[model samples]
Target: MTSSTDRVAIVTGGSGGIGRVSVERLARDGLAVVVHYAGNKDRADETVASVVDAGGRAIAVGGDVADEHRMGAVFDAAEQEFGGVDVLVHTAGIMPLSPIAQLDLDTFDRVQRTNVRGTFVVDQLAAKRMRAGGAIVNFSTSVTRLQIPGYGAYAASKGAVEALTLILARELRGRDITVNAVSPGPTATPLFFEGKTPEQIDGIAGANPMGRLGTPEDIAEMVSFLAGPARWVNGQVLYVNGGAA
Candidate 1:
């Protein structure tokens, strides 16, 4: 197992929601964290400040996840600031729900670009640069299995992520690095609550066997395990839903 001080991580979308909590968790675990944000510099700065206040090292970087050059700079910043990157938690994604029949072509393309293309760009960079013992964790959704209506476009994007997660793990065979995806079900994040009503939210929570919404920390704990000592658990998509699927 790698000691926390020797580990460095770049957490995309680390400025908010699940990403923010993951940053804090990893920092507390002693990893120097690079918090990547697409916009919202203030939130990113806040996250970094929180990490530092807790006596952990952290820096905030900004970039579009789909832009290869820009994301390359994100990796560059991590290496320049904290030696080399050891873990990457790709938590940046967009979910614009629409039925296939009514889904705007523009919206569909945008989602694909951010969710699918973005994962490809970052994963490619991580695969090339991460050290032998590194780990790459991509975010996916349980909706792909739930097959809920109005989630066709969103699910399709994440479906691509799941495919990449599996194929990339196999591609990295001889390397000690592990690649996996975390599929969370109905987490209590702003993204999940954006267009949802209280009744709708309650319905989703009740659908899970645990009868509650998953928390960002719940997902982060699993990520911490994968990013650190879970060496044998590769090429798998661990669904973090409460037995929802």
Candidate 2:
């Protein structure tokens, strides 16, 4: 097993939102990190700075999550900089909501590419290259169970993620690498707030028994666990939602 301080991680979407917080959390846990961004180099750099400021090692890399070559480069960077990647916290995805009937085919395809294909790209690389005793935490949404009307495209995309995550865990048998997904319910991230109004946010928060939106930190804590210590926990979608059902 890699010592905690010697472990390294690649956090896709580490530029902003939950991914950013997860990077910080993992860094604090003593892992060198490769912070990935889709288009926000500045945000990724800032995330890296935060880790570096805290006396951790980190570097920011930008790429399209669904692009194999680009994502390959991300892994390459992690290897080049930190020796090799031990954990992959794949929090990079899109949530463009529209009722199924109203959603355009183009938008639907984009959602699939970013969410499903992106997951495949990164997970495939990690499955092939990540060190044993590492973990993969793929992001999923509780809306898949919530059956929210306008979330058709987004939810469907995450459904694919769930399936891929489960199957990969089985396929990686005997590798000592744990693969799992985190299903978050109404986390207070920019993605969740994209088209939501204040009232809508309030209503969703009220629905959760906790009566508050899940913060990025809340989700990051779970990421920290799955990546660092949850060795026996594998092939499950751990719902971090505050019992919003």
Candidate 3:
């Protein structure tokens, strides 16, 4: 089991909703966190400030998680600031709503690039750099099970992530590292509430068994545990929704 002391982690997309929460949680858990943001430099700085204010170590970095060179620099930052990365939490992704007929091939390619290929690139870097006692946690969505309309392409990309995670775990069998994915149900993020009115937001929340949208902190809790001492759990897709799915 890894101790929550002096460990280092790289959280891709660490500036956004769930990513911010995960970075904060990991930093609080005693990991020197590298906050990876594609853009949103202000938000990334805010994440770093929040962690430092809480007496934890953290730094914000900008990079495309799908870019091998960028990801390598991220790993390098983790080592330069702290030591080596003991954990990786990839939460960077894009979701575009469209029916199969209306789905833009350009958007589909971008989603695959960011979601599926991004996970692959970062996971590959983690696998190569992380020593024994390391752990990797990925982000997926509960849409795979909910089969929500307009999410066909998005869910398909995440499905690839799920499969990659499972296979990668087995590929690393006998190593002390564990790879897993987290799938959250409808969450009350900007993405979820975007373009929706108050009534629509309530309606969406009402559809969930929990009667509410998920909070970033809620998902972060699971991420914290998975990346921490729970080394025994490997290659599992943990659903963080409140029984919504």
- In model 3, which range of ten residues has the least summed lDDT? 1-10
The candidate with the higher TM-score, 1 or 3, is 1
Q: List the residue pairs that clash in candidate 3.
A: none
Model 1 lDDT per residue over 1-245, tens place: 36779899999999999999999999998999999999999999999999999999999999999999999999999999999989999999999988899999999999999999999999999999998899999999999999999999999999999999999999999989999999999999999999989999999999889999999999999999999989999999999988997
lDDT tens digits, residue span 9-62, model 2:
999999999999999999999999999999999989999999999999999999
lDDT of 3 by residue, 91-172 (tens): 9999888987899899999999999999999999998999688899999999899897789899999999999999999999
Error of 2 at 5 (Å): 0.5
User: Runs in model 1 with CA error above 4 Å?
Assistant: none
Name model 2 segments beyond 4 Å from true. none
Write the number of the candidate with greater lDDT, choosing between 1 and 2: 1
Q: Candidate 3: lDDT over CA atoms?
A: 0.90
TM-score of 2: 0.99
> What TM-score does each of the candidates earn?
0.99, 0.99, 0.97
Clashing pairs in 1: none
User: Each prediction's Cα lDDT score?
Assistant: 0.96, 0.94, 0.90
Candidate 1 minimal-lDDT segment of 10 residues: 1-10
